[model samples]
Each structure stands twice: as structure tokens, then as C-alpha cells.
Target: MELQFLGSGDAFGSGGRFNTCFYVRDARGAFLIDCGASSMIAIRKFGIDPNTIRAVLITHLHGDHFGGLPFFILDAQLVSRRTAPLIIAGPPGLRDRLTTAMETFFPGSTRVERRFVSEIRELEPRCTHDVEGIAVTPFVVKHPCGAPPFALRLTVDGKTLCYSGDTEWVDGLRDAATGADLFIAETYFFDKQVRFHLDYATLARHLPELGVKRVVLTHMNPGMLARVAETGCEAAEDGMVLTV
Candidate 1:
């Protein structure tokens, strides 16, 4: 499978990067890890066809993490005229959050007639579910975004990928990332400890416990971006692609 960083910036668009979105595609099909507000723009910029995406697995309900659903769904219906079913899995209240977001973005948008079916699955913490072909296990994290945020473990095509989502140091991540092919972590800061955000130093201290094959840092602020070279770990950038 091939994973691409469609958008790698944090909520504030630090380093002039786009919001947090990742795209994965292989012989089976394609899916998205996170679809932030700028994901539509990033997808278009990367010349990706929205119709090919089978599912979107969200990490949390933050605008920079899940806000692009409104545009993605509307575009699929009005522009792509898609007929394939789309699976969206996330934390509890994801369905209601997307509905409110859609309506807030474009009034009465959810009630529109569409040729495709959009399925919403509210994932439970520690329990795994098969969404289309990807296996997803959500672990509750510390970010308080109306609904609970999650650190995710996803396995597909014999490759496992874990994401820290957006949180401080949490032991659950060790379980989520242990023996994974890739761990996409959120390094919001370089070394300064911040509430509800991970720092590079904190992640590094626990890296050995994770037992991850590879680590790619994402959702970084300016502080983290500036010191990425200091971390020596792979740092995600817009449009960077990795094959797993």
C-alpha cells in the first residue's frame, strides 16, 4: 500500500502547510486517514480523484482533523456524482458532528438527494472493526474536542499503522503502536511540555516501548517543524508519499 501525506500541518497551518490529511491507496482501493479543512484543496492539488476514495477514518472531531467531510461529501455528490458507498468511521458523536458541520457549512446540505450511500460507524475504544477492508481500532486519548479524541491503530494488506491522533503522553499509544509497520505521531512541540499535545522529547522517551518499525511525525506546530531535523525522525510534509 502507498500512503501519502495530503495535508501535514496542524490546526493553525504552521509552516504554511495544509491541514492534517493522509491518503492511502493500493490494489484493493483507496481510503483517507484524516480529512482536515484543507483536504479538498490538497486532494485537488495532488490530482487525486475524490470518487476513488472508499472510506475516511477520522482520528478526532477537531476542525483541522475532521472538518473536510462537509466539502468531501458535497463534492462527491454534486461534482463527482459518485455511486459507490463511502464508509466514515470515527469516535462517538461523529455522525451528529458531521451532520451539524455539513449544515453549518451549507444549510440543508445533508437532506440533499445523492446517488451514493454514506455510512457512519461510531467506533468504540479498544474494539476493532472492519471498515470496508481496513481494520480500525480506536483508543481514547486526552484531547477534549466535544467528543472523545482517539489514537488509532489501523492494519491493512499485512501492514499495521498507528496514529497518536492529538494527545499528550499516554501509555495506550504503546499498545496502539507496538510492532507496527509505521507510526504516524503528532509532535506538536519540540521539547516544551504542553497540555493536550505531544512533544518530541516525550515521544522519543517512549519510542523504544512502541517497537515501531518506522516513525513519521505529523501535525506539527512551528516549534516542532523548526526542530524536526533535531529529532532525526522522519517528518511528514505535504505530498510526501511512502510505500508500505
Candidate 2:
């Protein structure tokens, strides 16, 4: 399996981090873990063909994690002019969220027609579902956003990849990522304890317990990026790719 960090920046895009988005692909095809704001541009910057993406898995409804859906859809429809169907899977209320987002951004963007069909699938927390050819399971994460946050465990080609999509210190983290090939965890703070996000020290203490073969710290702020030189784990950067 191949994992590509399309955009690894936090909300502010500190240190030139684009946002929280990743491209995971195998011999079959490619899918996205999160489609945050500016993710489309980041994908294009990587010289990737957006039309080749078959599915996108969203962790929550936050703009940083899912705000780019309308644009991604529109871009594929108008710009790429793709003919393959696109499937989007996310937490509950995904359809409503996208509808509201479209209405808020130009009033009729979601209603636009395209060369390919766009299907939105809403996932229940902690429940496993199949999207296109990818198997996705979401677990709850502690975040201020009323919408329940999630961490995804993706199984593709018999390989598992876990993504800690914007979460606090949740108990299920270790289990969600346990025994996986790669764990893309988010460490926003270096040592300072904060709500709805993990600090570096806390993550360091928990990393060994997860039992994943590789750990990639992502969704980091400027401070976290600065501390990467000292941290032992790999600090995610835009356009970094890791194969397992």
C-alpha cells in the first residue's frame, strides 16, 4: 500500500502545510482520507489526476476536514470532466452538510451537473461500511464540533491504514490503530495539553502502545513542525509519500 501526504498542515497552514488531506492507493486505485480546504489545489500541485480518485472518506464535518468537497466535485466535473462515478463517505448528516455547504457557497453549486455521478454516503459512528471497493470504519473522537468526530480504519488490498482525523485523547485510538501497517496520527501541540487535539508528549507516550509498524504525525501546527527536528517520529509534510 502507498500513502501520500497531500497536505499535512493544520487549520492555519503553518509552515506551508496545506491542510489535513491524504491520498491512499494500491494496485486497484486511489482514495482520499480527508478533503480539507485547499486539498484540491494541493492534489493538483502534486500533479495527480483528480479523476483517478474513486472515493473520499471524511472524518467529520469541519471545514478543515471536509470543506473542499464541493470544489473537488465541481473541479472534476467542469475542469477534469471525468466520466467515472465519485463516491463520498462521511459521518452522519453528510448529505445535509454538503447541501448546506453548497447553498452557502454560490447557492447552487451542489446541483450542478457533471460528466460523472457523485454519490454521498453517510456512515454511522463505529460502524463499518464498504465504499466503492474500500472498507471504512469510523470511531468517535473528542472534538468541540457538535458533529461526532471520527478516526478511520481503511482496509485495502489486505493492508490496513489508520488515520486519526482531528481527535483528542480518546481511549479508542489505540484500538482503532492497533496492529495496523501505518497510523497517520495528529499531534497539534508539542507538549502543551489542549482539548480536542493531542500534544506531542502525549502522542510519544501513546505511540508505542498502538503497535503500528509506522507512525506519521500530521495535522500539526507551526510549533509542532518546529519540534519535528527533535521528535523521533516522522513529521508529515505536504507531498510526502510513504510506502508500506
| Best model number under TM-score | 1
**Whole-model lDDT, candidate 2?**
0.85
TM-score attained by model 1: 0.98
| Predicted structure with the largest lDDT when compared to the true one | 1
- CA RMSD (A), model 1: 0.7
TM-score to native of every candidate shown:
0.98, 0.96
Model 2, runs deviating above 4 Å: none
lDDT of 1 at 65: 94
RMSD of each: 0.7, 1.2
Backbone clash count, each prediction separately: 0, 0
Model 1 bad stretches (over 4 Å): none
lDDT of 1 at 23: 95
